[model samples]
Target chain A: MVDRHLFGLGLRKPHYGAFLDGAEPVPVDFVEVISENFMVEGGRPLDVLRRVRARHPVALHGVSMSIGSADGIDVDYLRRLRALVDAVEPLFVSDHLSWSRIGGFNAHDLLPLPYTGDALAVVCANIDRAQEALGRTMLVENPSSYIHLPGEMPEWEFLDMICRRTGCALLLDVNNIIVSASNHGFDATAYLAGIPAARVRQIHLAGHSQGRALLIDTHDRPVPPSVWSLYAAALERFGPVATMIERDDDIPPLAELLDELALARDIASDRERRAA
Target chain B: MTLRALQHGFRDWLTSESGPLAGRYPAGLAVYLNTYRAQLMACLSDSYPMLVAWLGEAAFAAAAATHIDGSPPHGWTLDAYALDFPVTLDGLYPEDPEVAELARLECGLGLAFVGPDAAAVDPSRLGNVDWEAAALHLAPTFRLLPATTNAAAIWSALAAGERPPPAERLPQAASIAIWRQGFTPLFRTLEAEEGEALALIRAGHGFGALCAALVERLGEEHGPARAGAFLGRWLGDGLIVDVN
Candidate 1:
């Protein structure tokens, strides 16, 4: 985990110039990037990442780990990710607790997983292989799902078991909690209460769009009021975890995102003062 | 359902026109299907902007939909999904050969962008080498894309945001050489003689053979001179990684 409560933003393409060539450093404590984008042999992407790493701490977040695959974790993917981790020496490495591949066919989207004991065993085995291969513990984030597969336990219970069995931590995505809770008719606050609070090492704050039947984790807009409230509650529980905001589409100016990071800092500060 | 059975069910629903997983996931089957298709489409559209421009937006969308339905992604990286699209274009627009050729060029450039890096052979180091027995090793990113039409010109025009010329076939076939120079991926249309020599080198031929072949075709006097010129150009282009 990071040294302390850190606020950061996703280092996207449009803001690469600003982050790399600015007169002053971007004010965030760290920057997160999609790991798959930089998992290349060598190119401009690696060059840019090296330059950026010189300025700020980076977190490697991936989308294709498919930790819940029934067949098994992709050993080749783990090897490449381990190489990237060795190069970046990131503050944290994380991927969603969802499967995108099964039987060699990768759908390339975060597909949902049932919370049954059998699925849990598969996930734990995969995480064990990943952590062993990477030589570092991973942070698995809960995903927002539109379909609620019938399972033996709630999502929080499943995550608690994963943390216990695989010795991995949590990258709690508050936005996902809201989206999934609303879609599956679970209590969002209850989820925050149910998770292993000490296991949360980082937190993701993002925006979502309401689809016809469910909330989609779009990450396009600013962190809405609802998500902010949950983030505050998460800080109260998780206690100053590393926080970052994600905006993948229709990106605005970097200053706007910094302002959002400032809000997160304020929330953590408020929680600390209340504790005092 | 068992975990394996459930996954196969989801795959079938996502990859085919089949109904929603035997009514097990009716709530968000449409969402998963939409997300799956949209992600693949966006990947293709992003990877082949030049092709998307050459083929209008609607036609490209239709082609992307067709490709996505028939081809499920198997690689961990979504970038690999775009590599096979040129073949799909070949099947879709066999009459317009430029379409497939343009897609191939785009895919080659993309691959070269992230391919293994190697330093070009230093000219100073080449001075004492035995010219006859030395084997020419090209950069790992080097790719030879066959061309029978003016696809390279179309790609260049579209990349420059200029109006592309009408698709036309070349009177003679040629090849395009793609490789990275420093950090930039580059491509050049190779002359027929140069293409054959490069192909020979790529296939592990020694410098003596290239020289002998050029000498055989262009005769000894101009052949050696032409071989020297090719060496000079390859070294300058950062294509020759090693001459051992």
Candidate 2:
């Protein structure tokens, strides 16, 4: 488990210039960078990441590592990822709690896992392998699923089993919980309450879009009012964990995102004050 | 079931029609799987919008679905998944040179976006070098595309959501240079002689050798000076990484 807590925002491209100029530093504890964006040979992305890393503690949020795939982990991908982690030296590393490949082909989407015991074992082993290769404790974030697997344990139980077995950490995405809960007809609060608090090392709050039948975790809008409420509940339960706001599309100016991050910071600080 | 067997079953279920495994999932499982297919198709479409526009959305979706069925995702990153698309599409659209070229350009753009970051050599770094003997190191972000067809014009038009003009019956081939100068990736059409010069330089030819290639192509009278001018423009454009 991580000792220090964080309150940060996702480092996005639209905000790169402002972020580098220090024109709009979000009043948060740190920042999280999408790992693949900066994994380049040389360009503005790395330059900006270097500048931001100098000012704030940064954590890497990876999209590809397909940790739950049936095929053994991609060794070359792991090597490149390891090289990046070493270069960036993030607070902690994390990827989606899903599989993304089958038969050596990459679908690129974080496809939902079956959540069966067999799937759990495969995920745990993959997590163990990733952690060993990375030489650091990595967090796994729960994916927002539109459907549940038959005979699968509750998502919370699946997460609990994995963390207990692999010694990995959790990056609890509050928006994902609300979105998944709404889609699958589960109680969001109960899902949060069920998690072993000690395993949660970070929190991700993002905006979502409403689809015809399901709430898509789009990360393209403001944090919904209910997600904010859920975030407060998460803070109350998890204590001061690393929190970040992820906005991937239709990105507002940096100041607007910073304002949203400030809200998360205030909630965390307020909760800490009450506890004290 | 063993992990391997479950994986095989899941792959078969995903790629082929839903059969016995249909019993294992709830009524919503089909819905989820259908959504998954749509999502994958949407992602592929978004990544290769030009190709979709060229092939028409229906055809593009069919081809993308076929590709997905044969090659399931293995990497955690989506960027790498579209890498082999051009090669795959080439087989399907063998008669359509436009289809293959547009796919190649889209894949190239995706690659440029996720390619490794290297420290760009400041132009001032070349001040100490002798221009005649110096061999220029192209930035890792630079890519030279030699084409027998007008791929760049078609790509630009397709990207802008417009249909390209009909291909001209020209005997001469064209080449394009794709590189990320800052954050944005750029594509510029290169003259035949210029492309040859860059190819020589990329192959570790010295300035003299590059000049010789330019002379052989453009003729001795204009070759050396034209090549010199081209190098100057390339350096100014930040395409050259080092001169050693």
What digit string (tens of lDDT, one per residue) describes model 1 on residues B188-231?
Answer: 99878899999999999999999999999999789999999999
Model 2, range A101-196, lDDT digits (tens) per residue? 667655555667777888888899899999999999999999987666564689899999999999998999999999999988999999999998
Per-model B-chain TM-score? 0.97, 0.85
Docking class of 1: medium
Which pairs, if any, clash in model 1?
A: none
DockQ value of candidate 2: 0.40
TM-score of predicted model 1?
Answer: 0.98
Tens-place lDDT per residue, model 1, A16-132, is: 998999998899889999999999999889998999999999999999999989989887788899999999999999999999898889999999999999999999999999999
- Indicate the residue-level lDDT of A160 in model 1: 99
Cα lDDT, model 2, residue B240: 81
Proportion of native contacts present in model 1:
0.70
Residue B202 error for model 2, in Å?
Answer: 3.0
Highest TM-score model number = 1
After superposition, the stretches of candidate 1 with alpha carbons farther than 4 Å from their true spots are A1-3, B19-22
lDDT of 2: 0.79
